[model samples]
Target: MRIVVVGGGYAGVLAANRLAKAVEAEITVVNPRPDFVERVRLHQQVAGTAVAAGPLGSMLRAGIATRVAAAHKVGDGTVTLDDGSTLDFDYALLAVGSTVEPMAGTVPIGSWEGAQRARAALAALPAGAVVAVVGGGATGVETAAEVAAARPDLRVRIVGSPVAATFTGRARRLVRDGLARVGVEVTDDEVVAVDGGDVALASGTGFAADLVLWAIVSGVPELAAASGLDVDADGRVLVDEFLRSTSDERVFAIGDCAGVPGTRFACQSATDQAGHAASALAAMIAGRGPKPYSVRYLARCVTLGRRAAVAQFTHLDDTPRDTALSGRTAAVLKELATRGAKFGARAGFGA
Candidate 1:
């Protein structure tokens, strides 16, 4: 069997590695870059505190081929690369992951490329400069705290919707306290415009920013839609219970690009989905029916710099619970979880 996996983000890498071990197939992973990006640690990269990427070859298991090119199109039983090369396959996995396009005047820290740009821009700024982070989700809060902790001299503030809005009331309070402990000012005002280093708020208030970082994820790649696959309104490929594309049984979609209901855009979910897809694919190749994919929510961990964090326990369906952990212990768990994610991807133990 010949299998081609597109994209090498958390989902793509984990799926490729798991598939390599689960089935007897010639696996080839197509990625735009030669390295695997640890997207969960991108905030650290922007703060100059950690390196989040390594050679892709080093992460994948032996006998799996790597193509350092973007996937231009994924057709039936074939994948077309950006350089006009084509690879024929019996099956394909579309795991292109998510993307973020910052506004004209803002830098983004969502993708590997954006993280590098943010790092350079942040490094060039002088001390006492105002750094405004737009968005109040996990990425936004993490980026604000990371930058504030790494460069205490800089004035860093996170402005947007409520910070950590997904967490429960107790967990949200913990996150707010953690942010305050790290000297990050939290704002609930919506940003209406970003122009010429000035951020205009919806309430008619504005502030001069020396640097602006956008932490919101905009959308996924257009490859699935462009290839005529059945995608949701957000352009994520719609998949059935088995993670196989609805329109093409030969293709499976997982991770951020897969329109799987109840799943969030996190490496934990991606790896978990990859593990299930591997098992399902293996079963299908063995002339047996594969089980439907399902995931149980464990906990959500958000790092507030290097010293503090908040871990919100969740029900099986991902709804937050009052039971939570905070401070150093939570930070340690967050670190362990991140390391475990990398190890799981490398060892093909995602399931």
Candidate 2:
């Protein structure tokens, strides 16, 4: 059987990698870049602390075919590439991820290339200038923490989210404590405009910032809407319990791009959802019963800096514990989990 996967992101890459190994099937990955962007660590990239590329060739079993194309159209069993080329397949997976959110109304920063460049801006700024990070989600928290860790001289001020977008209460407090430990100042209001390095708040408060960073977005390629797939209001591709595209059974969707229950855009969720997509697809190809998908992460960690972090443990249900961990111990767990999940791609479900 032949299968085509769109987007080389966390979901697409893991699904393609697992499926290629499971069925010995002809697999094709369609993405613009040759290597996958480790988007989860993009904040570190912006801080110039980590590399941006990931193991694309090895993840795909080292031999699966890949095309440098952005999917503009997807159907029952066909994908139309950006270059006007088309690939027909027996089964298709629409994992095309999101694009950056349009900031206010201007250009939406898409791709790690832009993210890396955003971080590069920090390098040339005045050494002891104040830095303002807008948004209070994971990306914002991580970015703030990394900047504080990397540049102790810069006065860092973070505006807490108006909405509880990432974590709340304990989680939010954990982040606050972590930031405080790293010498970052937290504010409750949002920045309305960025003029040069000066950030204007909605209440007419202006922050003298040498660097401004936006950290409250998860962008995909908009393939779900463009391909005519049924998507949720949040712009995720709607899928069934087994990760099959709701509108087209021949198509499967996974990862952050796919709207699966309890499956988030995190690397952990992407890895777990990949097994689900692979199993169901393999079952269909082999004329067996497809299995439904469910996800629950073992431990969740958020890093405060190089030394401290918080570990939120869950039990089947994704409920976090009241207290959190900080310092080197939590940092080690977070680091291990990220690295471990990368290797866990090799252990996929039966196709």
Candidate 3:
């Protein structure tokens, strides 16, 4: 069998590796870059503290072919690359991940390319310059704290509605305290527009920002939509309980691009989906019944610079619990979780 996996992010890489171990299909991974980017550490990359990407050749298992080109279109049993090349497959896994396109005059730190640009822009700024991060989610809080810790000379502020709003009340308080300790100012304001050097707020307030980093992800890639596949309103490919595309039985969608209910855009969730998809595909190829995909939430870890973190325990459905961990222990746990995610993708153990 010939299998083609599109987008070599966390989901695609894990799916390919796991599938390689389960089935005897000829697997090929198509990605725009030759390196595998650890997207969770993009904030650190922007802050100039860590490298988030490395050689992709070292991550994937042997015997899996890789095409260093963007997938322009995914058709029935075929994938067309931007370089005018085509690869026919018996099954295709669409793992193309999320993307971000910030408004004019603002740099985005969501993707690897955008993180590099943000890093260069932040590095070129003068001391005491104002760096405004527009988003209050995990990415925004992490970026704000990282920048403040890395460059104390620069003023860092995170503006959004109810910063760290996803966590429980107590966990949210701990995140705020951690951010404060790292010298990051949190503002409960909604950003309306980003001009050359001014950020207009929804309440008619404005702030001068020497550098603006957008941490919000816009949406997933348009590969499925452009190819006339079933997609949700957000352009995520629609998949059934087994992670197979609703429109095509031979095509499976996982990761950020897959419209999997109750799943968040996280590496852990992506790897879990990948593992399930691989197992199901293998079962079907072996003429056996496949199990439905299911996931259980463990914990959500957010780093406040490198010294502190908040690990919020969640219920099976991913709802936050009142109990949580903070301080150095939480930081260590967060670090271990990050390393475990990388190891899981490379070693094909945890999914």
Candidate 4:
């Protein structure tokens, strides 16, 4: 069987790697970039602590084919790329993930190049200067913490909307409390605009900042829409409980790209989806029909600088329980998780 995967982000790459070992089927991955981005560590890239790019060829297994171009469309069983390329397959998995959203007057930082500029731009700020990070979601929280930890000179302020209300129990408390204790200025008010190193608050208050990082409005690739696949209003592929797209049974979606009900977009969730897809594909290769996707998360860890963090271990029901740890202990957990991300690098590159 010939299987094709599109957009080698978290979901796509993981699916490709797992399926590579699962079957003797020919596999092809179509992605615009040559390297697999460590998207979870992108905030560190924005903070200038990590090099932004790694070659894609280094990440793939020996048998999988890699295409270095944007997927322009999907026709029949083929995925069309930006440079007039078409790839056909018997089975397809869509893992086109989301992109960052820019706030008022602020350019979004998503890609490595954009994040590099953002890091340099912030670097130019005077010592002990104030920086504004809008959005209180996981990305925003991680960005704020990474900036504070990586560069102690800058004052970090997080402006969040009531949507911050979405996070509950231990996870919510952990993030908010972690930010507060670590010197992040938590503002509940909305942002009205960003201009001339000043963040305008919805309450008509203007706060001066050395740099403004917009971490809201994360979006997805438009390839699903272009490919004539049915997409939700948010650009996510609507998938069934089994992670197969309802519009095309030959197509499957997962990770941040798959709009799984009641699931938040996070790397842990993507990893869980990756595991799910791995089993399903193994089933398919073993001469059984493809099984549906399922997800279960173990823990959620967010760093507060390098010394402190909030670890929320959860049950299968999504009920979060607190496992707060700080100092060297928490630092080790954060480092371990970061190292876990490196596993994908190995799966792609193969030691």
Candidate 5:
């Protein structure tokens, strides 16, 4: 049997590696880049810090074939590459991940190459230049904090999002205080348009800046939908409880591309989903019943800077607890979590 995984991001890589050991089958991972991108550290990259990206070979288990090519299309039991080559497989897993929503003339940290370009553009800006980050989600929060900490001379502001809406009251207070300490301004308004070095808010407010960073995380790739796979309104592939596509049983989806209810695009969720998909596939291959995929949220951490953060403890369904960790301790934990996410796939399901 042959299995083809059409992506190499957190979900794709983990699925390929875990599936390789599940059965005696040929497993191939198709990716455009040769290295694994630690997406959690992309905010650091934009702040001109070292990223956790490394060669793909370093992370994948031995015996898994790696193809450095983009998947152009997925047909019945076949994956077509950008170079016109095709790979036939008994089963295909679509984990193409996601990209940031297009905000013309702004740098978005949703893709590997886009983050690199954003880093360069940010680094080249002059001191005291104003940088506005739109979208106050996790990416926006981290990017604003990182920028403020890294370039103290520059003015950083986070626009959009109510600031820590997912956190408890105290944790939300910590986030607010941490951003203030880093000299980052928080604006609770939506960005309707971005002109060259200018941002127009939905409330008719406008601001000029040297650079604009868009953190709209609502963007998901449309590959699956375009290829006729069942998808939700946001173009995320709809999958069954076992992570198999609802439209085709031979196809599975995970990570940012999967339209699993209550699932987010976090690294932890991706790894967990990938492991579950592999386990289900292994069971099917062995003629055993596959287990249903289920996940729970433990906690969510947002770095205010290198030395400050807010770790919001949560229930299994992600409801915030009344207590939260703040200050350097939370910062350390956040940093460790980001680092661990890079290699978390190696632990497989037992982890």
Candidate 6:
């Protein structure tokens, strides 16, 4: 069997590695870059404190071929690359992830390249310049705190709704406090429009900043929809319990691109779904029954720069619990998890 994985993100790398070990199929991974990016650390990268994750060749298991090209189309048993080349496969795994929804005149910390651009823009700005992060979600909160900590002279503010609405109890309070401890201001408002050096909020408030980083929302590309695959309204591919596309049994979807009910757009779900897809494919290849993907939410870790963090414990369904790990312990745990994610991908599936 020949399997083609159309991405090199967390999900794609894990899925490709698992499949290579589970079966005798020839596996090929097509990605735009030859190196693996630690997306979870993009905020740190923007703050100029990112660790190296090595290249894609070192992470993927041996015998799995890789092509440095973007996948433009996915057809039955085939994938077309941007270079006008096509690869034939018995099955295809669509792990193409999502990106930040772009807003006018604002830099978003979504992709690796975008984060680098934001970093350069921040470094070029003069000291004492005001920097506004337009969002109160995890990414926004983390970015605001990181920027404030990295450049104390620069005024950093987080402009958005309640910080980490999904996190309640102590976790929510800790996130707010962590930001405050780092001299980051949290503003409870919505940004309506972004113009030159100014952001208009829904509360009739305008914040003029030297630079604005928007992390309000994310969006998936049109690759799956254009290829006639079943997707949700947001272009997220719909998948069954086994992580296989409901419309095309020969295709599997994972990561932020797969619409897994009750699962947030997180790296944890991506790795879990990748493992499920690999096992399901192996079961099918062995003429055995495949099991459904079972995912459980444990904790959500958000680092407040490098000094502090909040590891919010969650219920199985992702609802926050009253308990949490905070301060240096949480920061250390977060760092370990971040490092583990990067190196684990290089260790192959089930490592």
Query: Each model's number of backbone clashes?
Result: 0, 10, 0, 5, 0, 0
* Candidate 3 lDDT, 313-338, residue by residue in tens: 99888988888999989989999988
Would you give me the overall lDDT of model 4?
0.74
Q: Is candidate 1 or candidate 4 better by TM-score?
A: 1
Q: Which pairs clash inside model 4?
A: 34-56, 59-348, 59-349, 99-219, 242-293
Full candidate order by TM-score, most accurate first: 1, 3, 6, 5, 2, 4
lDDT score, candidate 1, position 205: 90
lDDT per residue as tens, model 1, 197-291: 89998889989999999999979999999999999999999999999999999999989899999988888778888888888898999999999
Candidate 5 local lDDT, residue 25: 91
Q: What lDDT is obtained when candidate 2 is compared to the true structure? A: 0.73
Residue-wise C-alpha lDDT for candidate 6, range 1-351, written one tens digit per residue:
999998898888988988888899999999899988888888888888774335888888989999999988898878988899899988999888887876898898878777888999999988989998988888898899888999999999998777777678888888899999999988888888888987898989897999999875578878899889999988999999888889999999988899888888887877878878888998999999998887677799899999999998888888777889999999999999877776666665532
- Those runs of model 3 whose alpha carbons end farther than 4 Å from true positions after fitting are none
Q: lDDT of each prediction vs. the true structure?
A: 0.91, 0.73, 0.90, 0.74, 0.84, 0.86
Clashing pairs in 6: none
- Candidate 1 regions exceeding 4 Å error are none
**Cα lDDT of model 2 by residue, 1-351, tens digit:** 778988776677777777776686788988888877777777777777787677566666666789987788888678888899899998988766655663542222235876766666778767788877777766677778888898888888787545224554676667678888888888888777877656778887877876667676665557787878898877788888888888898888877788776655567677777777887887787789987786777655677777778776665556665656667888898888766665565444322
Please say which candidate is ahead in TM-score: 5 or 6: 6
* CA lDDT for candidate 5: 0.84
User: Candidate 3: deviation at residue 241, Å?
Assistant: 1.3
Deviation from native of the Cα of residue 339 in model 6, angstroms? 1.5
Clashing pairs in 5: none
